[model samples]
Target chain A: MRVHELETPAVLIDLDVMERNLARMAEYCRRHGLALRPHTKTHKIPELAHRQMASGASGITVAKLGEAEVMIQAGLTDVLIAYPIVGREKAARLAALAERASLTVALDSEEAVRDISRSAQERGVRLGLLVELDIGFRRCGVQRPDEAVALARLIHDLPNVDFRGVMFYPGHFMAPEPERRQLLEDANTRLRRFYDAFERAGLSIGVVSGGSTPTAFISHEFLGVTEIRPGMYIFNDRTMVGLGVARPEDCALSILVTVVSTSVSGRAIVDGGSKTFSTDRYRAGDGRGFGLVCEDPEAEVEALSEEHGHLDISRSSRRYRVGERLRIIPNHVCTVMNLHDEVYGIRGDQVEAVWRVAARGRVR
Target chain B: MRVHELETPAVLIDLDVMERNLARMAEYCRRHGLALRPHTKTHKIPELAHRQMASGASGITVAKLGEAEVMIQAGLTDVLIAYPIVGREKAARLAALAERASLTVALDSEEAVRDISRSAQERGVRLGLLVELDIGFRRCGVQRPDEAVALARLIHDLPNVDFRGVMFYPGHFMAPEPERRQLLEDANTRLRRFYDAFERAGLSIGVVSGGSTPTAFISHEFLGVTEIRPGMYIFNDRTMVGLGVARPEDCALSILVTVVSTSVSGRAIVDGGSKTFSTDRYRAGDGRGFGLVCEDPEAEVEALSEEHGHLDISRSSRRYRVGERLRIIPNHVCTVMNLHDEVYGIRGDQVEAVWRVAARGRVR
Candidate 1:
């Protein structure tokens, strides 16, 4: 099937562009002697994960155990769950999954470590544990280097878990070009202190995994980091473009939508809305609207309801009529991919393959 | 199964609360002598639609044709798609759905009318058409009454399409109590003019359908409105409470999430994030965080990542520990329902039933 032949509100991935993104990131990692473990939370497809692995990814990183289970089922044995796992039910599930695949989990609290230790002991499997240090993103992770060493020491003494190094997400430092480079350098300086604290505590750090799409290319500045995990680099998004990590042309995924209504002047409604493109905003405070229209660069998606994307076409000279199809580059491709069940991989106009979003809705 | 037995990050519908909400709305419509056509976009479950139909709904309203198809498969014969659908693929699918159900579509343009007419003609079925008028909400509707009449006339003269009355969504008039009454009255005055103009054109208005959740109870204030279609009344959210349409106790749906991390001093992280609760902000601008934490009202969900909801518990007296479960009332229940695949209907602490979100991801 061709791109024009498909239905509206469908997710389209330019395979050529995606392959180029994959190769570029892989080569950059190889040049820096950094192990690449691309996060699968962006595409959530087994085919894409396999491609990343074939291109030179040592392992795949998932946000939850549900996503890791899906990847394990697809024969991707090495997996790293980058979120803190709590609750007895989830720990048990993770321990069971670890028996089948080489599993690693990030932890910040001792309670979570004890819970996972018990689950792994019951399942008779050893799980790799990474102490999550707060490099700046205050969402999760240990706040201080002392806390990181404490957690690492606790994990090392645990019966069924191995203390692997530390991991941090510098998501708070998303800026464009030179500013981003400086932000990364500052974050790396703090992270190196945390790594040295672990060494001073007589702990040998094996994997210092830390890197987001905004700072993926400049990850080498973080001297002690051994691996980098960048999720959105596979698809990219308006956020990456705003942060100067990627150009608009480097975005591989887009939503193919049709102009459904054009009754109101200066505005046109597209078939794709919050349910299709998602409500992810550019975190860099760029205020570039919800998504960008690829055909008319001037057209801005001012607002989005559940099923109607309100497009502001006042600045554009071209008039859009009903039934006209438009491709939109979403603000964040990760959330958009999670919203759809399947995505079409297109080469030029022809759809090369249809891949199911394998781990979509795997929030657990 | 019991509520406690269910995993974390689950969508739970309080069956007793849901039944009371359904009854209250049905009784409101009954007292007003208006036909009840409850929009099914809130729950998107076949069982819930059946319950609404049993409560005295004349029909069900869906946002997309894919939803109508799901309703039709569940033996629902009456459905109105309350959006302007374009493209040949959708029109053909809509026509096929019309053959199985009493299908009606909302249209603001002549091109959509012609497209549906051709599809209905090809399928040898007559589809009902409603001219959507922009009374106040300037979304997907004709701005002027003459444009509505023109579209209605076109539908009236079409090959296999019948011109129904008209439909309008007063979404912008969402306010609380006495102020909301004034807003509805003002919107009704403008809508009355459009209805009168359609009558002046010799078009007999059979079904003047309009009413959102915020203005559902006082729908009779709009003199000529014969029916009301409100989706969110079934599962009221923080937005509805801020608009004074429903109180917090009246909300039926709440996400059951477990606290995964509490390393931060004033903050705790839940298992549900944007992927589970969605990124819909409070529409009434109440400044309340993403969703209200039910157990501790003072605790606010300050921010959300893809799989983690950060909660600020400094103001709350209750202390949350890891693995502790909390119920959250989302800002918008419609979008949250779309995010999950299934919802558990519970009575008190017991799970009554598990209903699949039948029309989930039906963006087409």
Candidate 2:
């Protein structure tokens, strides 16, 4: 089927561009001697994860246990839960997953370590553990190098847990080249402190995993990092374009919407809104609109209600009519992917495949 | 099962509070001599819509045609899709739905009217139509009162279409009482223009629909409104609390999440983030946090990544540990509901039932 024949508010993936993205990332990692473990949190599709593995990914990384379960059900053997596993229920789920796959988890707290260790011990499974460090992005992870070493030593000594290495998210350095390079260097210096402390403590930290979509290309500059987990590189977004990491054409995903109302003088309303594109601000850009209108550079999704994408067409010379279809590039693709159940993979105007976002809303 | 036993990042709806909310709105609309058509876009659950209907709602309102389909399949006979139906595909879908249900749609443009009319005629179904007016919320609708009258006359003259009336959304008047009253009166005066124009045009204008959660109680002040559509009243959110329309105790919906990391001195990370709670800003409140932590008044979800909710516990005297569960009242309940598959309806600590968010991602 043709793309234009599909329903409005449908998410479309340019298969050619996506394949290019997959090959480019794989080639980059291969040349750099870095293991690529693409995070499935962005796409949340088992088919895409399988394709990533086929394209040279060592394993898959997921944010939640439910997502890991979905991927494992699709026959993925090597998996990593990159987020901390807390509580007995989640620990038990993680341990059950470990029974089927070569499982690894990253955590920063001793409490998380105890929870997962107890479940792993009960299930007779050895789980690979990575200590998470808050190099600069202070959302999660241990704040100090001493804290990382303490967690590493504790994980190494724990039964049924193998001390894998360390993981950190450099999500804050999405600025231009010079500034981003400086921030990565600063973070790399701080990351070396944890590695140096582990060496002094006579520990072998085998896997140093750290990378984000913006910093994936500069992984070689990340000091002793052995692997990278970049999720959004598969189908880049407006944020990636704003960060200068990807071009507008590199964004493989776009939300197709039909203009529903054009009665308001300067504004046109589309069928998709915050529920379709989400209210994620374009903080990486000028922080003005919700998404970029692919049809017109001057037009932007100025605002959104639950089901209305308010397009500000005041600056655009072209007038929008009701029933006119337009494609929008959302500011954040991950959240948009989670909002939908399926996405269409297209080559030109032809629909090549329809992939279910199988793990969508698997927030547990 | 108990609420605490449920997995982390689960959406919870307090049945007791929700029932009370239903009763209160029913009573208020009864006393005001107005029909209450609660918008189902907030919960997106068929059971909740049934409960609202049982509580004296005239019908259920939805934001999209797909949502209308979900409600119709659940045996709902009356539905008003309070969104424009553009394109032949959506018009055809709406026409098919009208065959089974008493369907009404709101539109503001001639193109929309033509599209829906063509499909309704083809399907041999009479679809009710309402001319949407822009009553200060510059989202969707005709900007002028004359435009509304013109659309109403056009609909009245069209075949296979019944001109219901006019629908306006006063969504921007969510301030404190005095300020909100003033704004409502201002909108009322503006709304009078459309009714007077209709009267001059010899239009009956039977069903005048208008209202939002923040302006539902004061909907009587909307000069000629006969029915009100309030979506978020049943599951009041932090935004309603910030607007002073609903108290914190009145909020029926919340997200249950576990503290996954507290290694940082003043920040604690929870399992739910933008994917769980959404990136909707608390625009009605101080706009400082993503959501309000119900345990401590001072603590707030300061930020969010894709899978991590960063809690700012710096102002509070509470010490958070890993595996600790926290309930968060999201800033906007509608978007949060769209993020989950099922919500646990609870009575105190006990989980009463689980309802699928039937129209969760029906953004089309």
Per-candidate local distance difference test? 0.89, 0.89
What tens-digit string does per-residue lDDT give for candidate 2 at B1-364? Answer: 9997898889999999999999999999999999999999988999989999999999989988889999999999999989888888888999999999999998898988988899999999999999898888788889877788888888888899999888988877866678776787778788888778888988988899998888898888789889999999998999889888899999999999999989888898999999999898886756788888899888978889888999888888988988899999999999999998899999999999999999999877
TM-score of 2: 0.98
The candidate maximizing DockQ is 2
Q: Give the DockQ of candidate 2.
A: 0.88
Best candidate according to lDDT:
2
Worst 10 residues of 1 chain A by lDDT: A279-288
Candidate 1 Cα RMSD (Å): 1.5
What lDDT score goes with residue A159 in model 2?
Answer: 90
**Candidate 1 lDDT for residue B145:** 77
Q: How much of the true A–B contact set does each candidate keep?
A: 0.79, 0.99
Chain B alone: TM-score in each candidate?
0.97, 0.98
